[model samples]
Target chain A: MKRTPLYEEHIRNNGRMIEFFGWELPVYYSSIKEEAMAIRQKVGLFDVSHMGEIFVTGEDAEEFINYIITNSTFQKEDHSIVYSLMCDKKGFAVDDLLVYKFNKKHFLLVVNASNADKDHKWLLENRKDFNIDIQNRSKEYALIAVQGPRSIELINGFFPIDVAALKYYWFAESTFNDNDCLISRTGYTGEQGFELLIHRDHAVRAWNALLDKGKNHGILPCGLGARDLLRIEVGFPLYGHELNEKINPIEANLGWVIKLDKECDFIGKENLKEFKEKLSRKRIGFIMDRSKIAREDSVIMDQEEHRIGSVTSGTFSFCLKRSIGMGIIEKKYIDIGKLKINIGEKIFTAEITHLPFVKIKN
Target chain B: MVEVQDSLLYAPSHEWIRIEGDIGIIGITDFAQSQLGDIVYIELPETDENIFMNSAFGSIESVKTVSELIAPVNGNIIETNEELAASPELINKDPYNNGWLIKIKIEDKKQIEGLLSPGDYEDMISGGNE
Candidate 1:
């Protein structure tokens, strides 16, 4: 199993370690629900070093990346990040990643750790016609995320960079305690937060410094469990569960990121456009009326007990204090409303709700 | 460190039984509650429902995962810990006392013989955390 640079730090903080996609990481430090609520109310630090970072440089980097991603980045501003998906010719998703356009000639792609090698190989095979130099920098950097309402205040104590003014999805290159750092005003948590990409050797120092500086701000070191719940509460699609090789971005409720009007025909543009026209299934948020908890792969059934769809991600929401989940249901039986889910022998009544089971206050 | 009541009999599934003749009070062990993290919901069997030995009676939902509550002995559910319906975190705080899950009318007293002692129960969970 691969252990990140923060593995020792996690052990020191009494983190409950678990294996996630070959990486040994913390499931939770204190408690999952408490850590999640802390991110909403105060501040939380996450050792996200397992995330993959790939650098694309050279003259034709911009043109190549635009064709690679579903989101068009032809005229994107510098220092901005765009969430996009890379799919196959049949419009099946390979991975969903963040494209950080550093400049016209350079870009950084932050992708899920489990999909790192596959994504890199996918991009490498498609760089034939474009002048680009691709480098896998996943081992070079350790990512840390300071998330919550007080993230800005906590980061200010370390390096007083006007983070409040930093627009969302934008990043700036700066030095933190004499170490080169790339700070991004982006996070999976739907709150005011920042993700710091620092050198691997300097990760421990940054982790200790953040915990010390954030002591007065009610900051706690969280784990992957809390991060998953935070994302689910905000209706974000996880690559494995909500999206996969067989899942299209349209059915995953990520059509907003796919640019259909871009003049340049991307790799999956034609299939995606056709899939959009025949979009039969749609993703949605739901709350189980029964006290029963729903989980992924739980079959969604109509009132007549006919199978309609299946759950993608489900969790007991700490914010709502109820069972909330995201599921892809058939568009035909969606109006039937108030469906039932048969986890096994147990059946639960679920009411269809809008995306984002819980709202994020600005 | 997990707390175990010395007088109570335990099941390998992490359930503890405090027997008083035919009536047995059941709750999850401290080790089980610790493994479960913050308890969000405990689906308890309704009163007068039949519960079988070594079978799933209900489920316990935490923030991350859901685990089935296995019955340690066969009996009818005389009463459930109604307090858990409103406040499930009590299991995390006090799993051995106020957080008892159910009270069952033990159909056979020999069922307690199959349970492990406090020392044996400690040895059971000495393996790595799952």
Candidate 2:
């Protein structure tokens, strides 16, 4: 299994280690509920170094990126980030990623760790006649996320520039202790947070320094287990669970990112447009009446036992103290009737609610 | 270090049984609760249900995953934990006392002898050579 640069730090902190996507990472240091609550209530630090980073540079970098992703990058300013999805010809997602634009000739793509190689291969296969260089820099970078209500105050003075001035989905190039770094106001926790992208060599020092500075702010080192619960509570889509090669962005409720009428046509524009016209399934969030969690692959049925869809992601939300889940069901049955989730031999009563089980000011 | 009661009998599956006359009070051990982290929900068997030895009588759901609560011996369920319905974290806080799962009428007294002693259970969890 691959270990991150902060593996030793995790061990010293007594983080309960687990295997995640072939990476030896921490599931939690104390407990999942404590870490998750810390992130929601106070502040928490996460070593998300397992995330994949790729650099795209060349004269046609903007054109190539615009050609590949569903979101348009034509009018996007430099140093801004665009959350987009790359799709195949059949409108299925290649991967959902954050595109950081440096200029018309340079861009950075932060992708899922498990799909890093596959995304690199897909990009290479579709380069065709575009003049661009795609470099998979997954191994050279370490990503740290500091999130919560107190995250801004914790990270404001740590950087050379003012991180509080950075708007959402925007990044600023700065130096961390004289080392090059990129501070982006982006995170998956649905809180006011920042993702600091630095080299792997400086990851250990950076993590330790943050913990030292965050000592008074009640900062705790969280793990992937809390991260998963946080994202699910906010209705975010995980790569393998909420999305896959066969699931398109439209079906995943990411239609806002699909710019069908952009100046330059993307890879799956035609197919995606047809899919939008003939939409069949839609993603929705549900909360169980009981405390029982409805996990992935659990079948969703109507009160009469007619199968409608399957759960994509589910967990016990510490914020709400209830079991919440997201699923894709037939569009016609969305608000028509009640839904039940089948777990093993038991059927749980679930009520369809709006996306994002938890609401945050940010 | 996990705490184990010397007066109780343990199953290899990490459940403990306190035998009193013909009744057995069953609950998961400290080691099992620690391994499970914070339990959110526990599926308890209904009263009057017959659970066979070495079979799953119920299940426990923690934040991470679900684990079956295997029966230590054949028994008939007489009562279930009522407090766990509102608060499952009790299992993690006190696995042996207030976190007890079920009370059963023991079917066979010989099965208690087949269970592990406190020393053997501790050794099994501590990675000691049996």
Candidate 3:
């Protein structure tokens, strides 16, 4: 298994190691629920260096990205990140990525760890017509996510830039510990945080520095287990569970990012438009009656014992003190009504609630 | 680790039963609680429900997974620790005392002879084979 630069750091923090997306990473330190609650209430640091970072540069980089991604790339200024998805000819999602438009001739795509190899190969094969040079720089840089309500206060102590000036989904290049880094105001958790991209050799120094500086601010080292719960609480879609090769962006409730009216003929544009006209299934959130946890792949059934859909992600939320789940059901069953989910051998009664089970106070 | 009193009887599944007269107090062992991280919820059998020996009586939900608690002797549940329903983390804090699950009226006292000693139970768990 591949190990990131923070593997030793995680071990030192008494992290329970597990294999995820071909990387040996920490699952939890003390408790998943406790760490998750800490991130929502205080501050938490995560070693997210396993995610892929692919750089696209050349004169036609802007036009090249607009042809492949679903979002309108021409409107974004330098050092701005836009969440978009790349789909196939049939409009099936291949991968969901965060595109950082560093300059007019350069862009950086941060993708899921498991889909890195496949996405890199696909981009290489599709670059024959465009005047762009693609390079996968995933191994050269380490990514750290400092998330929570106090993340801004904790990170501001190390950087010299004015963090308040950096808006959401924006990035800026700055020097940290005498090394060039990109600080982005983006994170999977529903909080005000920054994702720092530093060189691989400087990963340990940077991680330790953050822990020492943010110690009094209640910053703890978080793991994948907490990350999963935080993302689920915000109703964010994970690639393997929510978006896959068989699901389209329109059906996945990501239609806001697809700009069909723009004057550009992007890949899968025609199919996505047709799918939007006849959308069949949609992702919805629900709350269980009690603390009985519903996990992924649990079958969703109606009151009459008829199967309707399946759960994509479910957890006993610490913030809400209840169980919540996200599921994709047929359009016919999208009513704000009652549903049943089969967890293990027992069926649980659930009520359809809106997305984002946990609301963040601004 | 909480010391297992010599008067208490133990089950292979890590449950402890302390008998006084015809009534028995039952709870999981400290080893079991430590193995199952943080407890979030506990599903206990209702009062007056008959429980069979060596059978699945109830289940405990932890942060990572769920574990089934087995009955040590045949009996009828007389009472359950209701406080655990709200704050199940008590199992982690004091599994032997405050985390006791239920009180039962024993139907068979002969089953107590089959229970392992505290040393034997420790040997079984520390063997690292489970």
Candidate 4:
């Protein structure tokens, strides 16, 4: 399996390694519960170098990207980032990504690790009349996400600039450790954090430097296990589980990113407009009666044992001290009520609840 | 920490059976609890249920995954651990003594020889075959 630069560091820290998206990534260090709680209370760092980074440059970069993605890319200024999804002709989501407008001619798209190659091929095949060059620079860059409430304090301790002034979804290119790097105010966890993109060779040095500098802030080396739980707790959608080629952006509750009235014809606009008017499946949250957590692909059933939908993601939420899950059910079964989830031979009773079961008050 | 007395017979599945007269008190080993990492739910088998050797009696759910509890001996379960139905973490906190899963009436004394010794079970787990 492919290994990141911090693979040795993860082994040294006694991290349990698991294969994720063809890459050997750390699942946890001491315990998943401890690592998850650390991120919620203090600062935590993650080695997210496996996420794909594709560079789009040339005269027609913005126009090409705007035509492909389901977000208003033309309105975004340089050094801004917008969460978007690439859809097929049927308005079904291929992948959800972050489009970074680096400059007028250059744009970077960060995609899910497993869908990197597929997304790249799709972009190339659809680049029929657009004048743009797409380059897969995933192997050239390493990403680190330092997240939590005290993340700014840890970052400002080493960097010279005021990171607090950088608003959300904004990025700036700066020099760190004598190398040029891009720092962005974006993170998956629902907290104040930054994502740093640096050269691949300097990955270990930057990771160790941050660990050394942020030792006092209780910054621990988190892994994909904590990352999944944190994102789920905030009601964020994972690509393969919550989104896929069969589900559309509207069904995933990401309609805000789909701009249909922009006066320009784009891919999947017509189908999405029709879907927005008549959505059949809706995404909702469910809370299990006990700690018997439902998992992805588990069948969601009504009181009469009729299969209405399926669970997309489920886990024993540490913050809520119960089991919670997200599911896509038919609109007929979308009422705010109770339901049953079949987990193996047992059927767990669940109540239809709002997304984000645990809300952190600011 | 629960005590693992020398009088108890250990199973490779990390279950320990303490024979008291004709009754056998069963619980998971301390090593099993550590490996499971925080038990969240325990599904206990019903009382008076006949369990076959090496077959699944019930299941234990943790934060990461669920593990089936294999019956170490062929016997009839007389009593189940009712308290664990509400507080499953007792299995982690005291896997040997207080977290006992059930009380079974031993059906055969010949099955005792088939079980592993403490040293043998320790060597099997520490060999890192899992």
Candidate 5:
């Protein structure tokens, strides 16, 4: 199993290490629910070094990225990040990623750790005649996220640049403890936060520094378990669960990121246009009546027990104090208000609700 | 740092039974509850329901995963813990005492002899050869 640079730090902090996608990472340091609540109320830090970072640099980098992703990168300013999905020629999702536009000649793609190899292969397969160089920088950098309502308080003045001045979705190249790094106001949690990308050699020092400085602000080290629950609460589509090679962005309720009529044609524009016009399945959130948590692949049925779709993700939302989940259901059956979820031999009643089980002010 | 009571008998699957006359008070061990993390929901069999040894009686759902509650011995469910429906974290807080799942009327006294001793159960969990 692959180990991150901060593996020893995690061990020292008493993190319960577990195998995740062939990587040994911490599931939680203290408790999963408590760590999640800390992110919601105070502040939390996470070792996101397992995420992949691939750099695309050359004269035609912008044009190459535009043709690869569904979202239009035409007018996106430099140092800004755009959340988009990469789809295959058949309009199904290859992977969902964040595109960091450093400039017209240089761009960075931060992708899921599980999809790193597959995404790199896809990028190479589509690099037919573009004058761009694709470099997989997954091992060169480590990612640390400081997230929550009090995240700004903990991050401000830590670097030479005014971190508070950094706008949302924008990044600034700065030095941390004399090490070159990039600080971006981006995170998976809905709360305010920043994702700092530093060299792998300096990650352990930076993590310890942040913990020491954040002692007064009540910052807790979180794990992948809490991170998963937090994203589910915010209705973010996980790559393998809510999306895959067969599920398109339109079916996953991510159509807002796809721009079909852009000046530069993308790989899946034509098929995506057809899918947009004839939508079939739609992703929706539902809340269970009781504490019966609906898990992934739990069958969804109508009042008469007719099959509609199945659950993509589910968990007990610590903030809402109830069970919530997202599922891809037939568009025709989404308005039935209440649906039945089959878990084991028992059937649970779920009330259809909008995406995001909880509301975030920021 | 899991606690094991010397007076109780343990199942291989981590359920513990405190024998009191013909009534066996059954609940999960400390190691089992800790492994499951924060318990959010628990499904227990109804009162008077017949349950067999080594069969799944219900389930326990945590934040990230779900685990089936395996029965340790054949018996009739005389009473099920009702408080866990609203507050399932009780198992995480006190798995041996307030977190007891069910009270069963033992069908055969010979079945109790087959259960593991507290020391053996502790050894199995602590990576000792059992």
Candidate 6:
């Protein structure tokens, strides 16, 4: 299994290490509830170095990026990021990613760890007639996310820039303890948060420094488990769980990221437009009774025991203190009736709720 | 580190039973509680329900995963822990005492003999030299 640079640091902090997508990462430093609660109530740090980063440069960088991702990028100013996805010609998601426009000539794509190689190869294959240089620089950088309502204040205290005022989805190149770093005001948690991207060698130092500096504010080192729970509470779509090659953005409730009227025709524009017209299944949220904890791949059913769809992700919610899940179900039943989830041989009753299961502090 | 009570008998799946005359007070072991993390909710069988040895009578739900509660001895449930419905975190805070789940009327005391001793349960938890 691959180990991030902060592997030993996580171990030292009593993180329960687990294999996540072939990377030896922590599931939780303490318990999932305490760590997750810390993120919601105070602040928490996460080792996100396992994510993949790729750089696109040269003269035609803007056009190359515009041709692939679903979101519009040509009008984006420098030092801004767009949450977007790359889709196949069939309108299925290749991967969801954050496209960072560094300047007019350079762009950075932060992608899912599992889809790194596939995304790189896909970009290379589609580089025909475009003067762009694509390089997979995933190994050259490490990422750390400081999230929660207090995250901005804590980060702004130590960093040179006034990051608390940084607009959402904007980033700036700065230094921490003399090491050059890039900090972005973006996160999966439904709080004012930031993800600090730095050189691989500086990961451990930066992690410890943040923890030490923010200790008084009750900053704890959280792990993937809390991250998953936090994201699910806010209705964020995780790639393998809530998205995949067969699930398009429209079905995933991510159509807001797709720009159909942009000047440049993206890879899946026409196909996605057609899929939107014939939409059958829609991603929706469900809140289960306290007795059952729905999980991934659990079959979804109506109250009458007829199968409707399958759960993409589910958990015993730490925020709400109940069982909550997200599933892609038939659009017809999303409004009409109650839903149930089949886990093992047991069936659990649930109700359809709106997008986010928990209200954001913001 | 997991705490184990030497006087109590342990099931391989981490439930513990303390024999008290003809009664067996049952709860999840400390190792079990730590593994399950914070207990958010619990589903348990009703009082007077007969549960066979090594069979699931209920289930425990934590923030991360869920585990079935297996009966350690053949018995009829005398009383279920009703406090857990309102304060599930008691299982994590004190798995042995305040977090005790049920008191059962033991059908046959010999059923306790098949359960693991504290030392054997420790070996199982410590990975049994494998």
Off by over 4 Å in 2: none
Cα-based lDDT for every prediction: 0.89, 0.92, 0.87, 0.86, 0.92, 0.89
What's the lDDT for residue B51 in model 4? 87
Q: Interface Cα RMSD for candidate 2?
A: 0.7
TM-score of 4: 0.94
Q: Model 3, A197-307: lDDT tens per residue?
A: 999999999999999988898888998988988898999999988777666788679999898887577778999999899999888898988787778889988888688
The superposed Cα distance between candidate 2 and the true structure at residue A276, in angstroms, equals 0.3
**Candidate 6 docking quality: incorrect, acceptable, medium or high:** medium
lDDT of 4 at A95: 86
Alpha carbon lDDT of residue A149, candidate 2? 88
lDDT of 5 by residue, B1-130 (tens): 8899999999999999999999999999999999899999998989999888999998988987788888888999999999999889999999999999999999998998899999999999999864
Model 3 bad stretches (over 4 Å):
B1-14, B19-22, B127-129
Kindly list the per-residue Cα lDDT of model 4 for residues A144-215, writing each as its tens digit.
999988888888845556777789999988867878888999999888899999999988999999888878
| lDDT score for residue B61 of model 1 | 79
How would you class the docking of model 5? Answer: high
Provide the DockQ value for model 6. Answer: 0.66
For model 5 chain A, the run of ten residues with the poorest summed lDDT: A244-253
Q: For residues A1-362, could you state the per-residue lDDT of candidate 1 as single tens digits?
A: 99989999999999999999899999999999889999999999999999999999999988888888899778789999999998888898889999999998999999999999998999998888798899999999999999999999889746647767789999988878889999999999898899999999999999999999899989999999999989999999999999987667899988998998875768888999998999999888899885557889999999898889999988888788888888888888767769899876788899998878778886
Per-residue lDDT of candidate 6, residues B18-114 (tens digit): 9999999999999999888878878889999999898999999886788899999999999999999978889999999999999999999988889
The digit string of per-residue lDDT tens for model 6 on A1-362 reads: 99998999998998889898899999998888888899899999999999999999989999899899999887889999999999988888999999999986899999998889999999999888899899998898999999988897788766788887789999999998788989999998888899999999999999998999889889999999889988999899999878987677898998899999997889989999988889998999989875467889999998788989999998877668778989998888889557878987888788889879888857
Candidate 3: the clashing residue pairs are none
Tens digits of per-residue lDDT, candidate 2, A1-362, equal 99999999999999999998899999999899999999898899999899899899999999999999999889999999999999999898989999999998999999998888989999999898899999999899999999998999998888889999999999999988789999999999998899999999999999998899988889999999999999999999998878876566788898999999899989989999998998899999999998898989999999899999999999999879999999999898999546988998799999999988999997
Span of ten consecutive residues with least summed lDDT in model 6 chain B: B121-130
DockQ of candidate 4?
0.58
Clashing pairs in 4: none
